[model samples]
Target: MDERQAINAGKAALITLAVICLGALGVLVWEYATTKEVTNTAAVAVLLVSGGLFWAFERMFGAEAPRSLLGRELPTGATAAERAERRRAYAVDALALAISGVVLGIGGFMLGDPDAFGSLGLPGGPVTGAVLGFVALFVISFSLSWLVGEADSRAVEKRLARLEAQV
Candidate 1:
């Protein structure tokens, strides 16, 4: 892939990863705030540092071949609309990450506040629930990011199909 394409692909990957991390954060925050768990303070700190490391990887990763949802690498010479669409998608991915972050933050807060669950006092035990919820979200996001990356590949395939038909 060319430099521009590589950068774009990296941006997309980074944005997606960020979103997943944010989702995890949301759950952590909610759990902590509601439970008033002190251990969460350390966990959140660890998460923040881990996020920074991930960002660093985005800058250092190898060349990226932009792919579509279908997993086909995009053509080097995509049309204006196609390229724009990809960029737009990347922006959305970034926004998704931001939303996830906020959710996780809220989750953490909820987890921290023991009084927050007052009305809902119908809980058997939130300890296991919180752990399970966070883990599930992180795993789901991890898988989704892997599959969604195929979007780039799919776009590439579509472009190729268009070119082939024109031939």
Candidate 2:
């Protein structure tokens, strides 16, 4: 087969594998939900092997392979305007994450206190766990945003340098 046909075949195989992996995961969840325990070692193995295979195939086929499989195009660097838009998007994501962190923190604090009305009947731990969770989530969200922005900026710089050198 030609290159396009080969790519299509590879994508189809990946999709099939993904479906199987998802099915395995669903089965594990179902088993856990029904029995309160997961005894399916085989299914877990399937998921682990599938993950390894997926990683290996992506390496073999190049980065675009999975993106194409997901019907997404590789981002071809970004302009200043696009970068600004991304920053706005990241800011929104950070805000959402912060709100979620606050909710989780309150929930954790309430859960840790036996006097709380919504206590889930578990052994209570320190309320500091809640504060830690909130802080961790806040830090992680901003760190991720910063890392992505930095990577995008570096990619743009490289592309610009290449273009300038060629001119």
Candidate 3:
């Protein structure tokens, strides 16, 4: 296949794999909730839903997407080389997104802290803390995975472009 075709194929494969993983995750999450406590169910549900959402987002809006989708949004026009460069930048941007998720998680933990919330005049206690903790983990893990997948797609696209250029 050509450079663009190969990149698209890789993206499709990754999305398919993510969908399969989410299927298994759903089952496991259900079992975890039923076997454990009811309070823990929301955490698992959030984790699973967030993961699915992240994967779907990446599948729809990776390196290959913004080119076609955002071109109308920017009339400046982009050459093949510029598109390739954008792919690289998108890969780096994914990392920034992952870092943002981490930072948000840290802030969530602080805000959700029992003692900390008391000072804030909205203390909900451990249940609140645990729920927030689960949300943090879910958001962090899902965001990181989604970013990594997009970055991987960008790398694949860039590599394919280089190979095509060499040939």
Index of the highest-TM-score prediction = 2
lDDT of 1: 0.57
lDDT (Cα, tens digit) per residue for candidate 2, span 87-138: 5555566667876766765775567744322333444433454445556666
Q: Write the per-residue lDDT of candidate 1 for residues 11-94, one digit (tens) a residue.
A: 777777777778668868888789876466655775787678675764354334564444555443457776565555544454
| The candidate that achieves the highest lDDT relative to the unseen native structure | 2
Candidate 3 Cα errors over 4 Å, as ranges: 37-161
Instruction: Write down the lDDT that model 2 would get.
Output: 0.63
All candidates in order of lDDT, best leading: 2, 1, 3
Candidates in order: C-alpha RMSD to true structure: 13.3, 7.2, 10.7
Clashing pairs in 3: none
Estimate, for each residue in 26-119, the C-alpha lDDT of model 3 and write its tens digit.
Answer: 7666776787634455555656676776566555434442322123221112467755565455445454555555555556657764343123
The residue-level lDDT of candidate 3 at 154 comes to 62
Q: Which stretches of candidate 2 lie above 4 Å from their native place?
A: 1-3, 65-95, 101-131, 141-167
